[model samples]
Target: MAEALREQQLCLSRFIRDPHSNPAPPGIEARRLAVYRQLFLGNMQSLLAGSFPVLSATLAQTQWQSLTTEFYACHRCKTPLFTEVAGEWVSYLETRSDLPGWVAELAHYEWIETVLLLSDNADPAHDPEGDLLDGVPLLSSLAMPLAYAWPVSHIGPDQLPLEAPVEPTLLLARRGADQKIHFARLAPLAHALLVSLQQQLLTGREHLDALAQRAGVERGALERQGIALLHGLKAQGVVLGTVRG
Candidate 1:
């Protein structure tokens, strides 16, 4: 009895996740079940794909179907509620080895925007708190900084090319101080710097020095450049808050 119940649960969830699958069995009449199953899958797919249009575009119909199938199968999403599905879809891609690395990053890049826009975090607006010279911190309230070895930002089916550009670009995606989500192009030096900050590697002069050593650039040069980049981040609303005095 328990096993039958489990099967029913799996079948129902599958039907909900993607209605375009194998037909329902003996007792579940195809007529009414078909309406619900197809409707459920269509809506779920549309919601998730809309959020990650580029990823959706890059994948073939089969690939997208398979990817989402795997997502529903392996990932135990706490919420059976449909809204949480997209977030879990992105999470599964991140942890799954079969997913293309670039695809994973692209999925995440897409997911973060929706997640942030819908977030309830009460991180009130505050002026970026320090002098650029003090090696102050910079970040956006809705702007969660991400660093990727794969150039996921500039990726599309063919248009926004994904090959890691020889020159790395820092990506700052944020719901603006004006309540708009904005995307910024970042320079390599600046990308590296923000990455450092995101990873807790650089913040003050010490953070700058560490990155400078990695790049083999003069310490003084990076310090000057760091401050300049700091100013630029604030201008773009990338500066979220100070690292704390």
Candidate 2:
């Protein structure tokens, strides 16, 4: 009985994993299978494309179909649910050998925005400590900040960037206190500073000091910038506590 159940699960997974190829049970003819195959493929493709419109627009139709085909083959999402499929699809693309480095980076650039928008985690709406300038942990509300070595911030329908940007592009993604998603380009030092602070590699002061060194700013200027950043964080509703914690 258990073996039969497992086989059933595998059969359904195969249909979902690559609907264009496999369809229903033994009694179902290839023609009948094609009907289901079309629906399955179209549904999944539209859902992903909706979330990644820029990415979809950039690719040729043939390439888009091929890309989705590859995704159907490579990704084995542990959950049976479809809502989380986008996460697995994005994760799959990051390591896919057949895809070019630039395309992988571009997909990730768009994927993160979706991830932030759907994140289930929620930090408090307000910080009671209220010491915005203290040297405590500096974190994005979700603390899953990411950036890329390419300029994917301006990804649009007009065209894909022909060359990678010499400078790194920072991505600040978080659900704001207003319950809306915000994604913005960040300076390299700012990205490094936030990442360092989140990893506890440095305190807030230490991060600002590093940024100051990199940007060739004076200590006083750095302190002022750090204070400003804290106020920004407070406004975003991610301040957890003071350094005394």
Candidate 3:
């Protein structure tokens, strides 16, 4: 009896996971098996649709359904939580060769908004009045720097570009004290400086010096520009403030 039950379970599982290829378990009505298959796949489709509305809108219905079905059959999600399923779908896209070059990047960009909102990192302890140039700058725990080959922020049904631009798009997404996630377009130098701050490998002054050297500019000029940029970021809650040593 135990062996028969195990066989029946395996048969049902296979049929449900890939109904097109697998036969229903013996004595189970085909109509009942069809309902189970639709229910499981439909629920996953809805979840992914909610998580990636933009991506869904970009792809035709047939293409979208095919992609989701492939994901359901081929990918073994690392996480069991439904909240992380979209992340798993993104990972699956990373391995595919048939997808458009921007598909994976766009999917990831969309997924990041949700990831930041759910982050547990609290506001760091710092001095809001501290000098950005003199003190160690503290990046908000929820701040994320993202670089993309395609203009993912601009991509939609109407704005899809076939070729990537020479300069990549750089963006920063940070959760403000108001609990709102805000996004800003970043210049190259600003992006590099913020990355350095996030690494905590140097003081704001040192980072400015390094950036100045890289840009072949006088240190004083870079310092002035960088300070203003830092102030703007602080106001937006991207930079929490400076950490006192």
| Candidate of highest TM-score | 3
**How high a TM-score does candidate 1 get?**
0.75
| Candidate with more favorable, higher TM-score: 1 or 3 | 3
Per-prediction TM-score to the true structure, in the order listed: 0.75, 0.79, 0.91
Give the better candidate number (2 or 3) by lDDT: 3
As for candidate 2, its clashing pairs are none
> Candidate 3 regions off by >4 Å?
1-7
Per-residue lDDT for 93-180 in model 3, tens only?
Answer: 9898888878999999999998888889776578888878878888888889889999999888888889999999999987776877
lDDT of 2 at 20: 58
TM-score, candidate number 2: 0.79
* Candidate rank order under lDDT: 3, 1, 2
lDDT of 1 by residue, 1-245 (tens): 99999988788767655455643544777687778766765676688788889999988889997776556545688788665677888777878786667888888888878877776766544445665555457454576666666777767777555356665445767787677677676667777777666666245677788888998989998888877777777776677656454
Name the Cα RMSD for model 2.
3.6
Candidate 2 positional error at 242, Å: 3.1
